[model samples]
Target: MNLVPLAAEHVSGHALLPFSVYAADGRLLLPAHAPLADVRVQAKLGRQQALFVQRADHDAWRRGLARAVDKVMQSNASLSQLAQARPDPVPPVQAPLPGEEWEHVVLALDRAVQAARRDVGWVRAVQDVQAQMRAMVCRRVDEALFYFIHTGSRRTALYSSRQALRCMLIAGEAARELGWSEERIAVLDKAALTMNVASWQLQDELVCHVGPIVDEQQRAKIDRHPAEGAWWLRHSGVTDPAWLEAVQLHHDDSLAARAPSSLTPGQEMAHLLRRVDRYSAMLSRRAGREALSATQAAQQACLGTDGKPDPTGSLMLKAVGLYPPGCFVRLASRETGIVLARGERANAPVVAALLNAEGASMAEPRLRFTTQAKHAVCTAVSPGLVHVDPPLDRMQALHVYLKSNGPAA
Candidate 1:
């Protein structure tokens, strides 16, 4: 018997199975001769779950399956070619004015976190943030990260939302560079933002804990967060299959190990999200561990725990740069600054010097071009190393400076 998705609206009512339908895992979902309702279809899709109906007619089902398989194969072939071709280095886009739109995102995320107990309102808040992010154009990922980190550090005691936003921005950038369509990129952005929402409390605790997790119960909850978050989104009325699937598999590393030939589109996006998530975690400062330097994070990401090369690692490193935006660094000249924009080379980035060689805070931020060896980045520093009278104001001023300098080529 040929199995087909229950969501194909064009299928005739007569074509549906007269017998009970089971999910892929053999769980009975729809009773015999049940009429397919739009709500039911949506709920199933929201979980990134699928229900299959056995074809009443074998011949037609075979034909449909053959066509579906062929299409997927063709798409995979094209993706393979695209992956092999080295993408040209695109100049970094200019940072957009972080006025109302940036504030809106922060507010929306805050509301979402607060409304998590109320599922519908929380989902609406998430959608609001997604809409704002989709509407935002030509904004540098680093700029977004800077605003998110600075704002979140001051506004909330929890770091989950901040980490979520960082992952979202990083994943969105990677998706764009990979030539994903805007719609797909938006879905990715939303998925990344909500990937850890279900277990925020637990995650916050774990992030603050020193060393590795020794509690099996806590470890299990952390491991199950992705699936739990996907379930919550489904119950909250999320109907996009791609968004659901990306969230469900965001923590799965096995997808990265799979050969491209055997991978599905959802798995491909999941690979990207997983890589970005790992990289973002490394750059973030947890309670006991200082944030890894951009260069160190890049190296760790490129070489996985098992010593295997990650397929998306190089792309992430290139996109983020050796001194990713929002990161603190000390220059060869003994000055300290925040990375402003990616330079022509991955190791070279434009930095806004906040401290002079003597460790005194500069009166105003000075833009330094790291392409010149004399002003090269000496080491990635932690934020605690330097003092800024008004941290957020200095960051904003640096953003304005980068904006005025034009896009990096």
Candidate 2:
């Protein structure tokens, strides 16, 4: 056997050895032909610093390595082709305009669902749909959310779609902050969008129930939705393992109990989705209960199922910030405003003032930078707390105004 350093830089995919790979102390690192993508294998190799492989298999190993390299090259070329096939970029808008973008997205989703039901594999169409979602998410998160909320809120049963979108947004923002690559972020975005599709396909009345899903039959549907969604995606020709895995495990609470060492990359993404999903569901208004305020949602997200604090929950709060965009808040000056965007600090966000300190609605919304303590958020308030004239139009106008002003420094 020949000894070789098992550094990440040198290893790309699975490295096949004719015999077992061993560490300096003679502990077997991996069996022959095992994929080296496992984090445990990588960690063990890292700790050992080197591995021994059979020299007799050098020729066979070289052949296998070449095949692996060729496969990776082909995969990358395919991904590149997909990336290059992007649709024309939507132009930046000073004001959010009425457009058929949401309708188009919904139509694409409907088509995908139909294709899945027919057992027809239309991978290209699915990819295009994901591309559209990625574009909308990157360019206009607020506008995308506006459509999701309006459409889903109109039908109580489809509220989960709104919640899913919220979770997707939060997860996307958090992933971006973590410096994940654009491609990875896109995968995350698509995964979040489709993760709950199966559940949404159920009868609207059944999914829209206000309280906890205590009925065994209903709970069964809820529990199976993740896997069902993943199965649909797979049959529709989604070959991305990470994307498929994320959809399947998005609701797996057991991930919260696993030690970090045992978590896979897929599980890590699942963990993020789970946390965001729980938080979004809590903040969402349902049949019998009022939605939790942003602050309360944040507080709830910071605790584990057992009521103890969790680091991931804390990270989620920090990522989402004190006043996430679109939420209403009362300023220290008693002026009520809607958060426009995240500011330089998590606790502070740019806000558009809808009311004065005296509680009178403003004729035109004024942009306020909450970086200054006087303008900082006092607490999250209910939407009805503000006296917004022609509330819908004013809110839309304010969103446009915020877009025009750009983010506050």
Candidate 3:
């Protein structure tokens, strides 16, 4: 069983517990909805390093916390509420932030990676987490891409797992666009996310590390990560040859150009993973290097080692487009905006303008269709340059926004 560390606020005295709390060793310390007033439970909690709950319930617990906050905001409740009695186990649900779901999936994926350190239940943990991602991708590819793109630009922590999520989404979407079957897509997603299982912490550190790989042992570890990761996955109950091979061969892009008819499933997945892995990493921020803009990343991701457009790279472009949703772009009008959705053509994206031509925040975000010459994408913008946060939910509801009020006037 997977367990997540809980924060103190999860069991605040002002609200009932959202989920049963557990001690580090998995003993139930407090049942769901239990009041914290019990001195016995307080005593039990005092000796533990931190509280934990089953990984699956973590979301419900979080949603409950958000619910509580919304309630307090609406009803003028506060720490003052602690003095009064309350009986409800859960606060009423509210609309979640656009990026919250991405956060949950990435957190769950991280837990699954941590679970790999154990001999038991790692596969189930990974499958459960990735299944959630696949469902999101399937339900709405646009929404999934929107959150994925929007998320990576701002967050600075958990680089390994978050990068994996980015790769998984790219690979999954690319796979589906290629008309691969459901089972194939599932295996590819699992493989893409966990391909760095051996170097999860190493990647996280190196991404933020200012200097070169000076240590010999560290260099060797980096060199051997792919093979070692595959071995660990095999030992941890991953029996799919395709999945294991993808992890081992993930760094080799040379295989990406081979004919699909002649390749084994593993080789195909490895090729896709190799390209998308690098592609995703390029778009992500690193302390030591500047991140590439969306257009640059897309171009660089698809080129072969020989400096030419590659078949696999071409597939990614065809599938995800040149300016994928949630990426930033500069318009012909000099307004800076984030791509809201892929338009009828790849070069033309639906945009939500965040900055006027002068680089000041707009009176209100204006919707633009790159299909129109006046708003055509002139260049990709650095995400860091976008200080003004755009309304993510509204962008996701682009169709409604346009129907109610057509594209930028």
Candidate 2 per-residue lDDT, tens place, 209-244, comes to 667767888678887999998998877778888888
Question: Per-residue lDDT for 308-336 in model 3, tens only?
Answer: 66788888877777888778999999999
Best by TM-score: 3
- Best-to-worst order by lDDT is 3, 1, 2
Each candidate structure's TM-score, on Cα atoms with residue i matched to residue i, is 0.68, 0.66, 0.73
Clashing pairs in 2: none
* Stretches of model 1 off by over 4 angstroms after superposition: 1-104, 149-156, 304-309, 387-390, 407-409
Task: Give the alpha carbon lDDT tens digit for every residue of 171-286 in model 1.
Answer: 77777677889888878878878888878878777777888889999888888988988888888888888888888998887887689778676677778888888877777767
Candidate 3 stretches greater than 4 Å from native: 1-92, 305-308, 396-409
Instruction: Go through the candidates in order and give each one's C-alpha lDDT.
Output: 0.68, 0.65, 0.77
Candidate number of the best lDDT: 3
